[model samples]
Target chain A: MSAKTWLPLLALAALTGCRQDMHDPPRYRAQGSSDFFSDGRVNRPVVEGTVARGQLRADTKFYQGREGGEFVKTLPVELTKDLVKRGQERYNIYCSPCHGMVGDGEGMVVQRGFRHPPSFHLERMRELPVGHYYDVITNGFGAMSSYASRIPVKDRWAIVAYVRALQLSQNATMQDVPEAERGKLSQEGRQ
Target chain B: MSQIFHPSANTIAKVSIFGAIFFAGGLLVILNEVNRSPYVTRVGVAREQPVPFSHKHHVGGIGIDCRYCHTAVETSSAAGIPPTETCMSCHSQIWADSPMLEPVRASFRTDRSIEWTRVHDLPGFVYFDHSIHLKKGVGCVTCHGRVDQMPLMYQQNTLNMEWCLDCHRAPEKYVRPREEVFRMDYRPQESQQVIGARLVKEYKIRKLTDCSVCHR
Candidate 1:
């Protein structure tokens, strides 16, 4: 072939060489081997007393939901309307799938044949301290996994407060509603 | 003196000219085909998996929420694959003897995870978080197309960097209400731009153009 005819083919060959297919870079995969470390593991163990940034977790009552080996009776955070609202939203997204919107433990997951969790309306559940809920969420119970990774610390407290509200809701009597609100209930009754 | 016969150069020139044109046109056609080929984009190609899990039957027919299987989408970076227990929760009682679900049963018994083939894989350089996207009001249908219609899951978008930047540059065009994020069939009641602009302010969304935002 003439030089001119071969020029185009040469260009195509050169272009093909420039492909970006080098995906596996020199990096360690999870639990990969390492030559630099004496232990031969890619991940190094945390140094003694080395706390990750923003993970000091000094407040035992707030982090661990306990004081002197007993669950705290009161919520660690300040209760507010917004906090409960946030809790309601978070609860529907996370807890409601298995615990039901009313905390009756008849969630969609259970309807699909998963183990049924006890209803919050039970006397045993209602009598349990707020910290007990926090502990269960922080470190799972029965077949349920720990939600600590999924729910942040403050959100966990918020969910605990919402669960308490749910317990009160199922057990509430006519006296629980104010006299003014009672009229609204009777108005709906007429309809 | 002898009259020398000259070869016809005209025919050679015409042939070379036509050949070059034909080669260029053929090259263009081939390149275009390669660009849209299934091998490159994988759009509409249903990949084989260990289990033939049908999103159509599960999501559309059975009316299961996306979060039921992808439990960690709201909080974690990854939309986690459901564990064997999630399948056995239903299959154990319903399709207990079905040969198709034997893999699920085996996985549950062995406590081994099913090696599901990833469909919408992004390059290692790009970091995409499901939580931030869902929290920002991007619907499941926005990038995934109509997944409820797919019997077997397949990638619906090119998922190229250019495709990603098209939305990130102007998120208001695609953003929906937080409640509507999981609604697979959700359509904007008003113009998307008007709703998106309001949500942009409400959600405090800023236009992120920095390479480090995703590249890092």
Candidate 2:
């Protein structure tokens, strides 16, 4: 062959040799079948009672939202300003899409046409224990899906605190606010 | 031998062969350049969808939050596309009879999803989690551009590996306060480097260049 023809051929040969096909071996992809296992699945069962790193949920009250087979009335986490702020942020991101910013059940999503969630201001909702909110978020209710996969456990309690705050904001009398803070409501002529 | 070979004809043949080779090489180079251009890549091109949803009207004019429609952005790997019910919620009251929203109404009635053409598509090999990015305070505008300004959504960034690596190598530069993640118009009051350094420490963001970080 001519040198010109051979030169292109040589370049092609060099390029072909650099293929990554060998690096990507024929292997079982995630959740793929494997005849080597008796169950014909590549995924191994989580060994008997082994807990995953950083996933030990020994505290039934915090992790499960329940104690003694009943939902707890109060939050397990300390209700700090930062924690409530975090809850507000998380609520706006996750719950506000459906539950509205003030928990009025008139969120943009509901206004747009999805099923309206019950208002937090309702006597029944206000009377419900705080753990009920966490339980609902963890397991989902009616049309809503479980938020457990998205929100961390600590954040879930934080959200519960915010929900309680929302319930109070909606149902509060003038006495609920401090004397100094009451002036802000009167300034808006809402008092 | 003299009769069998004509010098002038041989010269013409050699010149033509060389010309053909050069032409072919030039054509290949031009083709490669064209493929990489914005026109071919559809970088700013507004892709046609089943319905002509205007981000300018929804986001800019009305000031709807990004989370209103993309509900699963904070928790799911994929940013959840709004179901048809979300559209009908408003359209059923406002543009009840507009032909433009017929697809939405039909999808709502049939319980079928509207097949929205994906704009920011990554390659199959790359694994991107929207939840992780949102949790890490990477604002929607960082990768999606100023969507509020777009009349019709388009692929703002190239979304290539190089583009991803630019931020992955130094996440602090793009990190913002979690509260500001959804604020489309938010601008850093301080210099990005200064704010980013603080956010990097606060958020505990590590500069990740590992191939498996994305490739897996």
Query: Candidate 2: which stretches are off by over 4 Å?
Result: A1-87, A90-167, A170-175, A178-191, B1-32
Candidate 2 C-alpha lDDT tens digits along A1-191: 89999999999999999775644446754344567987565657788889998879989899988999899998888889988888888788678866888898887757666678899999999999988889998987777766775677898999899988888777889998899988887988863
What are the runs in model 1 whose C-alpha is more than 4 Å off?
A1-18, A22-58, A178-191, B1-16, B52-115, B127-131, B148-151, B204-216
**Global lDDT of each candidate:** 0.84, 0.81
lDDT of 2 by residue, B29-64 (tens): 998889777876678999999999999888886567
For each candidate, give the interface RMSD after superposing the true interface residues on Cα: 5.8, 8.2
lDDT, candidate 1, at A91: 85
Q: What lDDT does candidate 1 reach at residue B43?
A: 87
Cand. 2 Cα-lDDT: 0.81
